[model samples]
Target: MGGPDVLATWSTGEHTGAALDGKSLTFPTYRKGTGPGVIVIHEIPGLTPQVVAFAEEVVAAGFTVVLPHLFGTPGKGLSPASLATAFRQVCVRREFTKLATGTTSPVAGWLRSLARDLHDELGGPGVGALGMCFTGGFALAMMVEDTTVAPVLCQPSVPFAVTPGRSRDLGLSPADLDRVKERAAGGCQVLGLQFAKDPMTGRRFDTLERELGEAFLRVDFPGMKHGTVTIDRQQEGVDRVLGFFAEKLH
Candidate 1:
């Protein structure tokens, strides 16, 4: 744990054959630390140095952090080419819903299952889920399962923000949105972070506020930056996420 640029070696594991509706997905996962489990879902360019650095911060804060390799090359730093390639892949994959509104990305089901298994194994109040950039809204969608007690969305950027309507979309189907509302009412708190003028995030925070009311805790900084906890690396945003996890998961 030297720093964000220099990280400790991760204990690798594979989520072999994890499926939803008969659609199976297998990817490499990285784990470290010891405490309540927190699943750190990476953003568009995959698990870049910044993303892993943030996860290491979580580990240092005393929680077991599991990072799943969704796309891009692990350990590779973020770059324009990497971002373009990952975004293109997400668009082509059936697992993600890029421009569609009111639909949960099919990949969310697999992530929910992963959350459930982690919570079951760790056994506590529940697990914390933090999804960044392209996968940000996933934490909310993962709330469909009881195991995801603390959901953090840092610059969610889903449904691709291609249109005004899509920008406002939370990337949850109507049914899943209702489930999330119910979970919020039942005491689940969702933490969202974004730059105040980040176009990629659109008005999804407004949607979260409208739907979840006080349960949607948001941290909007003053800028046009998108990746609040990753490439942008806002220290306050990182501290806020760690604090939110501490209050909810511990």
Candidate 2:
């Protein structure tokens, strides 16, 4: 795969699909693998090769993977310009909650609906959800619903951390947070990965520890690398996510 700056050819082969939300939000999705369902939400710069590579890993681990294009152009590489462009789009889009605290992105409801549909189709005990960067905390929100059995949050930076409250917020409403906490306490282990030096994550991991207790399995990296699991690919993080899905979904 090429770097984020390079434009990669987009495809719509066997793995191509879309999730329609009330005739409004048509989430263009890609899928691969077979077995349990795993919804991998892309970061700010969209479903780049790095993100797809990570999803391919999930598929290889004996699970079906769905990659959603939330922000940027699919197959576009991540670069400074791409990041800025996608970030800007997120800011202006009504579907995404860009600069607020304790509020789920409007698109999350659509994602939750999509997960349930997938679970019904896949017919497993439940499904796995991995959301990175701008979509990271999305998995946590999905846990409030029943179908998401495995929720892995990798450097889930959202709401921009523009304020003190948002820096520690999970980007969930109070009711949603309570539901997620309840599920975590009920033995639903939530996995999280972050670079110790990444300021974008703020104190969200700490908040996770406080809310979910031992159920929040946090894996922290050593540097300021933003996307610990993808663009800044870390095999350890990848293995952890895949293992968690295997343990929880299968």
Q: What TM-score against the true fold does each predicted structure earn?
A: 0.95, 0.91
lDDT of 1: 0.87
**How high is the lDDT of residue 246 in model 2?**
90
lDDT of 1 by residue, 1-250 (tens): 1232333478888775444456888878889999999999998788888888888899999999999888877777777888788878877788887878988888887888888888889999999999988889888889998999999999988888888899899998899999999999998999999999999999999999999999999899998987888778899999999999999988
Runs in model 1 with CA error above 4 Å?
1-8, 17-20
For candidate 2, report its TM-score. Answer: 0.91
Shift in Å, residue 58, candidate 2 = 0.7
> Which digits, one per residue and each the tens of the lDDT, describe model 2 over residues 203-239?
8999999989999999999998888877788889888
Clashes of each: 0, 2
Distance from true location, Cα of 172 in model 2, Å: 0.2
lDDT of each: 0.87, 0.83
The per-prediction CA RMSD against the true structure, in angstroms, equals: 2.3, 3.3
Candidate 1 residue pairs in backbone clash: none
**Ten residues in a row with the worst lDDT in model 1?**
1-10
